[model samples]
Target: MSASSAKVRTITRIAMFAAVLAVCSQIAIPLPSGVPVTLQTFAVGLVGYALGAKRGPLAVLVWCAVGLVGAPVFSNFMGGPAVLFGKTGGFIYGFLPMALLCGLAAEKELPGRIFLSAAGLLLCHLCGVLQFSLLTGMDLLKSALLVSLPYLVKDLISMALAERFAAALRRIPAFAHTKC
Candidate 1:
């Protein structure tokens, strides 16, 4: 493919990934503290695997921007400037760098392998812990152990599954040109 065409493809992939993430945000598992756990991160990992570093973070940025415009794209259909400026805002805004850095770290093969997914998950945790500490005023170590560690195993599994799924998707005829 020509350079221009490749850039277009990358941009398209990022848009598609952002749309998928917005949809996934609706599938929320409510937490006791009013914050919910959602499958958005799973899509985040998938986008990173499918699009690699450059497009993956671009996708995340799109998602964030859409939500900021009162799109009701977040968990429980909550959105708008208030959604970002509220208490949960930090975590919401944090998704960009988390996905960006994680995708950058995992930017290796076409479909991210297990090791890359694990590393990406770890990066996500690090970003999350940082945000959690900054937002909640908790110590970094406490946030890491309490907030980051509990979700580590689950997020790892999700990342691995997302990577494997991307690998499978890339083999299909429809996605052949996109390279998934």
Candidate 2:
């Protein structure tokens, strides 16, 4: 393909991943703390793995932009600036860095990718718990125990699934040629 065509294809793929992230965010389970467990992180990690460092965060940015603009694309069908700045907003904003970290790590070999993705997930949780605690006047340790701990296993599973999906995607000619 020509250079321009290749760029177009890459942009198209980024948009596709952003849409997928939005769709995955809809699969949310509400928690008593007003936070929701959504498949967003799974899609975020998958986008990073599939799109690499350059495009991954851009895709996440696109998703965030959509939600910020009242698209109802966030967890539990929430959206707009209110949701972005709400108690759970940290996790929403954290997705950007998470994608970057995961994509950068994904540039490495399999074991490295998994390890880095987990680290990225940890960062997301940290941001999430910190914000949750601050907004709710809860202690940090309590926030971690109540909000973050319960989701660790689930997020790990999502990370693993993302890795698997990325591996499969890597075999496709369109993705195989792209470099991180």
Candidate 3:
């Protein structure tokens, strides 16, 4: 393909993944600690694996920007600057780094992809726990136990699924030609 065409394709893919992130954010089940169990992380992993380090974080950033601008694209359809600065904001913001780290690792072999994705998720959880503790006036360790612990297994599952999905996608002609 021509250079311009390739760039357009990349941009289109980024936009599509951003939309997927927004959609996944809406599939949330609220928890008592005021955080939600959502598919956001799953989509984050998928975007990272599919789009790679450069494009993946762009998609995540776009989704975050949309939510920050009051598009109701966050968990439980919540959005706006208030949500961006709220207790759960750290997790949301952490998606950018997660995508970058995960995508970078995903460009390697399968084991590397899985390991890095888990690490990325851990980073996200750390951000969430820290912010949750700060905003809610709870002890940091307590917040980590309450908020981060409960979600570890599920997020791992999501990362595994994203890896599988990305592997499958890489076989397709369109994606096959694309590089991380």
Top candidate when judged by TM-score against the true structure: 3
Tens digit of per-residue lDDT, candidate 3, span 61-127: 9999888889989999888999988999999978888898889887877654566777788899999
| TM-score quality measure for candidate 1 | 0.78
Q: Each model's TM-score, in the order given? A: 0.78, 0.94, 0.95
Candidate 2's residue-wise lDDT over 1-71, tens digit each?
79999889888999999999999999988889787788988999999888888899999999889999999
Candidate with the greatest lDDT versus the true structure? 3
Every candidate's lDDT: 0.72, 0.87, 0.89
Residue pairs clashing, model 2: none
Q: Residue 169's C-alpha lDDT in candidate 3?
A: 91
Relative to the unseen true structure, what is the C-alpha lDDT of residue 111 in candidate 3, on a scale of 0 to 100?
54
Sorted by lDDT (best first), the order is 3, 2, 1
Error of 2 at 100 (Å): 1.0
Better of 2 and 3 by TM-score: 3
Stretches of model 1 off by over 4 angstroms after superposition: 1-9, 101-116
- For model 1, residues 8-75, the per-residue Cα lDDT tens digits are 77777789999998998899888654456778778888777777677787888888898988899888
